[model samples]
Target: MIERWSRDQVLALAPDAASQKAAAGVSAPAKWLVTGVTGAVVWGECKGSGAKPYRACVDLSEPAYKCSCPSRKFPCKHALGLLLLWSADGAPPVEEPVDWVGEWLDQRRERAARQEAREKAKAEAEPTEKAEKVTDERRARQRAERVEAGLADLERWLRDQIAHGIADARRTGLRDWDELAKRLIDAQAPGVSSAVAGLSRVLRHEDWPARLLAEYGLIHLLAVGYRRSAELPADLAETIRSRVGFSTPKEAVLARPPVRDHWQVVATRDEERDRLVSRRVWLHGRATGRPALVLSFAPVGQVLDASLVLGTTLDADLAFYPGAAPLRALVAERHAPATPIQAPPHGIRVAEVPGLIADVLARDPWTESWPLILTDVVPARSGDAWHLTDHHPKEENAVPLLPSAAPPWNLAAVSGGHPVTVAAEWTPDGLRLLTTWDEYGRVVTL
Candidate 1:
């Protein structure tokens, strides 16, 4: 018998508590008809609800899984259960894999070999930079035409909302919006489709009428912006194009001059969807005082790219993506890994709220959210309403907190009745805090 992992280690791979529980339930030897451990690979045949058994295999060396179960969940329950059985105190004996397992392993090896060959060919036959740019631009133009058609359709749909009363949003079915969004997806306009889906979510809210109108306005604004994009400034035009689902080439962005700064990582979040896991890291440039979001993605179980440690600063050069509000960016180069640093005495402070709004809307009206760092602000509660107020109560600075934001409990606790520099997002509704740096230079995510 061989045991490669502790029970806890095996269960840790489960995506959720439910999967962990289910894996434990099916870990008994009676549940598996055949079990074998061969080298770094574990293979098992578990009798499932169906007449035929389901095959499960895990490659311990690379920590990969392949299962015949129909469950879309990566490393499906069967894989987890097989690992649990293998990790049991009296584990399965090391034996040569059965015929079915051998076939699957062979297929995996062949696929990997083909992939290596393809990558090798690509590396050996790399296109010249000029050729690559020309190809990329041509593809971008074709995609832009499709996006334009989709935006036109979305604009017409927004106009239809005005024909009927705002209450008509309730009568509009979820599938109706989803269907149009799917069409936009087919038209390669994911940004507009995402906004359409957001509108659908808004319609379910208690204040659907007002939310619907606002979303309607946003779509109309984007449509109008798209039409007059060519007439706008170069950067603003790029911003509108990006908002309408046009992607800037990473190589092009990297080729541009990089902004060297000591960037402080403010907040970090990881979102897992289907087979992909995306990491969004927000970095605040200490020198330039600009906020940038660096995004990275990996397969479900793979390790992510270099991480951005929260509350730490890194001397790095970041390449900003072309946009009117250039928050999204890529780390082009780094002088050193991030290190802990005292909270610098600088965060962008909007002197005039209306002026900030006018500036952002002027650059890109359809921007749903923008980075906002408020200096010396405190979370406050007043007669069934919550908002952030400037340190001085007598001062004229008070902005309502968005309903969806993390309640101000943590912010209040961290503040302890004092003002703090807060990093938040400005939406159409109000401010939503992301991270806060207190007087003691301590950082907490709200």
Candidate 2:
């Protein structure tokens, strides 16, 4: 039996406003040469100005779209129009799809089957690769020993800095810190190395001494936690291991039980560091009301994964990495293609965000930032700095925006001094806006 999608759901797949408007224009019954629905597939040929009519088809299972149009947008106008027609019960039911639709379906099935076979073969061969597995474990143990020695050396160096006073360390210069970071990298402790490198950025601040000491305390705590990881709780030990540079395998994360939900793709941001581009996608599960972070990486100048689009809701299963605060996850299985999200699954008040971060920090002290959706917050400016203040009369909550971020003139323009829903990243520095929903419910990426 075919499960019909609503017109709103179909239109939600449009890539942009122009595509949505164009799709509506072409959705009339008279505009199509012929339209039919066979099983879960809806297909049609739309009359166009060109000699040949445009062919469009939609696979409801994956909710995939294909159109023989010049438009580069996914779910081109013709495809969206066909879906809109189908949604309105205008496309007549048929026994079979036309030649074009049948051929496309066959090709999709063949590709899916090939992928399945590859994965199956890899899974079957894993048990026979015992020698390789043993070698990997041996190398991991050797690296762990090196990391232990490096941390011990770091602890001694930290003590020496404190003993000699902050002035002496300041005079030693950034080269000394860079050499220590290099040693941590050689020890295969990239996580700690990153933390060490970040300390250099703090040197530019006004109260460098106090800030430096606080950062040093955190690093010292990480070293102590790693040393006493064996005595810690299982989850806490995993957290410590991750903070010390050990990574949980993607396959291992997927092997765990999956959390199925309508995961709303709230925001996506790309960052470049050390010639590598990293993409962070934030998801909010409707049913569970839990936030999940999906990360992808590519070299500079290369395209990152464009699968998760902003404002789309994915019916999928996500498997989380092992940790006390399990925010990072892998998409274990996608039940359907991404669709438009009407609104945020859940949102918290500006006052409640701190408590949430505190809870996460209690579980994973090394957590650098958290993703949050703020409700009824209006963008306001005080002198040169900006903040998101609660619009309600009783609540006196206000959170500062990241000082380094460009002045959100677009956001202020959208809000026009009114309350708006915003999805942002809460870092130790300040809030970094990602996406916002205006009065018309349109998504605006900051």
* Per-candidate TM-score against the hidden true structure: 0.65, 0.70
lDDT of each: 0.81, 0.90
Question: Model 1, range 1-446, lDDT digits (tens) per residue?
Answer: 23479988998899989888888887888999888888888988899999999999998887899888898887788899989888874345566788887898899899999999999888776766668899979997988788888888887777776875666466764767888889999889888788887777776578877777888787788778888988888998888778778788899999988999999888776789779999888788887877888899999999997667888999999999987767889989999978986864376444566687788787777866777778877888877678888787567668889876657898998889887888877787787778887667888778
In terms of lDDT, model 1 sits at 0.81
The most accurate candidate by TM-score is 2
How far in Å is the alpha carbon of 158 misplaced in model 1? 3.0
Candidate 2 whole-model C-alpha lDDT, 0 to 1? 0.90
Please, what are the lDDT tens digits per residue for candidate 2 over residues 1-446?
77888989988899999999999999999999899999889999999989999999998988888888888899899999999998999999999899999999999999999999999998888876877899989998999899999999889989988887887556664877889899999988889988988787777788888889988998999998988888899988998889889998888999999999999998999999889999999999988989999999999999999899888999999999998999999999999988999865569989998799899889987888999999888988899999998998787789999998999999999899888889999998899999998787878999
Which pairs clash inside model 2?
none
